[model samples]
Structures are given as C-alpha cells and as structure tokens.
Target: MVKRQAYQPILITDASRSQHDQLRSRQLRYIVMMSIRAACLVVGAILVGVKPPLLWLWLSLCGVGMVLIPWLAVLLANDGPPKEKYRLANRLHRSQRDETPPRSLPAEERPHPVIDAEQ
Candidate 1:
C-alpha cells in the first residue's frame, strides 16, 4: 500500500501585505508629510506678519521643515519593504571551497530501479 503524507498548514505571518495596501499606506504617509509642510509655510507667514519674538528663529525652523519634508517624503514614498533574509539575492555568497562536495550514494543503496538489457 502507498503511504500518504501528512497535511501541512500555511502560516499567515509568512504572507506579505498586498501591493495596493502598501501603495495606499505610502501615499497616505506622503500626504501627511506634505500637509505638515504646508502648515510650516502657514506658520512662517504668520510669524512674519506678527513679527513674533525671536522672529528669525521661528522663520528658520519653518524654512527648514518646508525644505526638508518634501525631499524626505519623496525618498520614503519610493522606498519598499526590506528584502527577506532567506531570499536568494539576500543570502551570503559562499565560495565552492567553503562547501562540502556532494556525496554519491552506493549503487546498492540508491533507490533508482535497475534496468536489465536481457529482460
């Protein structure tokens, strides 16, 4: 009688998020960052109009945020999830010298069927 193999269950943790979900998340992050940048511009304008105390410092902070946020947002939006450790490209490249040579099984022990020319 042939033996049957046991069933193996797939784990959900191993699955990656869908591309649409990932893209939606990245788009949301970019929008939030841009919103913050707009807030900085508005704050800078308000500081200029009011001539607040330490006006230069307030303007500088806002200016820095306005300049840096878009650049950072673009970088983060373009970035993807990190590669898995077990992926072939991410695995360490080993030289042939570091590996053990493949072992050959003896003819008597090998599972292949023997064919006879006389049969």
Candidate 2:
C-alpha cells in the first residue's frame, strides 16, 4: 500500500480567490456525498439484517467510509491559512536556481553615490 504524504505548499501567484473557493466547495460536496452513502449503507443493513451476503457488503461500505472521512477532514476542514501552498512554492523556487550573473544596469543610469554596498 502506498502511504499518503502530507500536502506541501505550492502557491501559484496566479491563483485567484474565486478558484480557491470553488475548490473548497467541491471538497465539501465530496464530504456530503460520502456521509450520505455511509448513512444509506447503515440504515439498509439495520432494516434488512446483516446476513452472510450482506455482511461483505456492509464491510465494504465501512471500508469506504473509513477512507472518506480522513480525506474530507483534510480537504474540507478550513485550517485558517494556506501554509502548505507557500512552502511548496519555496521548494520549487529553490530547485530552479541558476548561477548566471545579473544583467548590467543601463549606461544612462549612474549608480547613486549615497547607496554603498561595499560597507
């Protein structure tokens, strides 16, 4: 089984607030669907009885519920700020470093005498 990894922050400068809200809403919808599916399975089991055949079905539903709950907690539960996104972006920036020298300033612009970097 592949172990799940924690989410890393990878902030995209272009991401808009509306996009974030839309993603949050979709996550909430998944949480609701999983909840309803679980309820249906439990009520169905109680109404019809957990026989040998139904036992396997019940177990399967329980397994699905187990998986869904954690995912819902991670994706939909608002955790105040998006720290993960920022960290991820930093990691990406670090991996893309190049050692080229910076472009020289234009000849028309003289260096300001008051600004001393040699200090």
Candidate 3:
C-alpha cells in the first residue's frame, strides 16, 4: 500500500471566507462519514447474534458504508476550495513554457474558415 502525504495546505489566507469554510467543512465531512462507518462496524458486531434477521440489515448497511466511505472520504478530504479552481488550472506543473495570450484579430481581419470552406 502507498503511504499518503499531507501535501496540500489546509487554508489559504488570501482566499475568500467561503472558500475557507468550504475547506474546513469538507475535512469535517470526511471525519463524520468515517465515524459513521466505524459506528456501523461496531453496532453490526454487537447486533450480529442478539437479532439474527436484523443482522443482515446491519451487515448490508455496514457493507454499503464500508464501500462508499473510504472513497468519498478520500475525495472530500482531497478536494480543494473553489477559489483554487481557476488558479490550479494555470499551474498544471507544465514546463515553464510561454503561455502568452493569443493575438486578437478584429472581426473583419479574422479568418472566416466556416464561411470560406462552404464555398
């Protein structure tokens, strides 16, 4: 198994308050889901024999929790705040190549490929 790393920053001060709150809540959501999953396991074990039919229900619930919790937890935990969305797009670890803006051409000067190709 690969070891996980805390590579991301917890909060960016320059970001908006909403983004900070969103990041904080995202981490909390993962913790809550994980706690629920653990509770399912503990309750399932305790109820395994005291109620046999209900055991199946508990096990099914546990199964679903087990399957979904880790994946969703990882996703939520790894998710970045909304403000970073556009900034991250520009910093894709690509080499320091020039990303100059495209030269603008006036509507009249711009090539009308669709118009010309139809001829």
Candidate 4:
C-alpha cells in the first residue's frame, strides 16, 4: 500500500506512486474476486464428484465464472483512477470572487423597486 500526500491532486496519467497505488487497489479487488471464483469452482467440483447429475447446473455456472473472471480482471487491472475533480466553489479563490457581479443586479433589470418608498 502506498501513502498519499495531504494536499496535492493525483494525476491519472502521471507515472507516480499515486498511479501505482490505484493499480494496486484494483489488483486487490481482482484478488478478492478471483478468490471467490476459485471457491465457487472448488465447491461445485466437490458437489459434482459426490453426485454428478445433481450439481451439473451449478458446475456450469462456476465454469462460466472461470471463463469470465480473467477477462474482467485484466480490464480492471488496466484501469486508472479518474483525474482530480474540483468544483466551481473550490476552484475559485476569494480574490477572484471580488471580480464577479454582486448578488443584486442593476436597478434597470427590475420593473418595480425591490423596496417600496411608501411606508
């Protein structure tokens, strides 16, 4: 397992520890998936050997998992974590906010005065 720094964003394409960590995480998931697949196969085989006809349907399902798991694992292993996503609020600095228009628009925009003069 790799340690990530406190502040910096991890670039998906960078050849850094962050990318390697992402791959490691994915491999860990694949390991769990494959472990479960193997367990299913073993159990299915055992049941089939004891009484062949009864477990045939289950064994077929296990075979399907055996065939598909490797393909899925390879695809997952190649996948990288998504690039850092910063929202509008997080991206803009307080200084930048000063440049933007105020909450209230110009008086001309509203036909009626927001505050009535008569009290």
> Judged by lDDT, which candidate is best?
1
Distance from true location, Cα of 21 in model 3, Å: 4.4
Per-residue CA lDDT of model 1 for 53-84, tens digit only, reads 99999999999999999999999999887665
lDDT of 2 by residue, 58-109 (tens): 6677667666766666655544444556756754575466333333633223
List TM-scores for all candidates, in order. 0.66, 0.35, 0.48, 0.51
Whole-model Cα lDDT of every candidate shown, in order: 0.72, 0.55, 0.63, 0.61
Candidate 1 backbone clash number: 0
Give the CA lDDT, 0 to 100, for residue 44 in model 4: 78
Q: Write the per-residue lDDT of candidate 4 for residues 42-110, one digit (tens) a residue.
A: 987788778766476877888898889878878887776443343223334433544534436553332
Model 4 earns a TM-score of: 0.51
Reference-based lDDT, residue 97, model 3: 42
> Which of 1 and 3 is ahead in TM-score?
1
- Model 4 misplacement above 4 A: 1-17, 82-119
Global lDDT of model 1: 0.72
lDDT of 3: 0.63
**Per-residue accuracy of model 3 over 14-80 as CA lDDT, tens digit each:** 3344557877888799889899889877877777757877677778988888789888899888887
TM-score of 3: 0.48
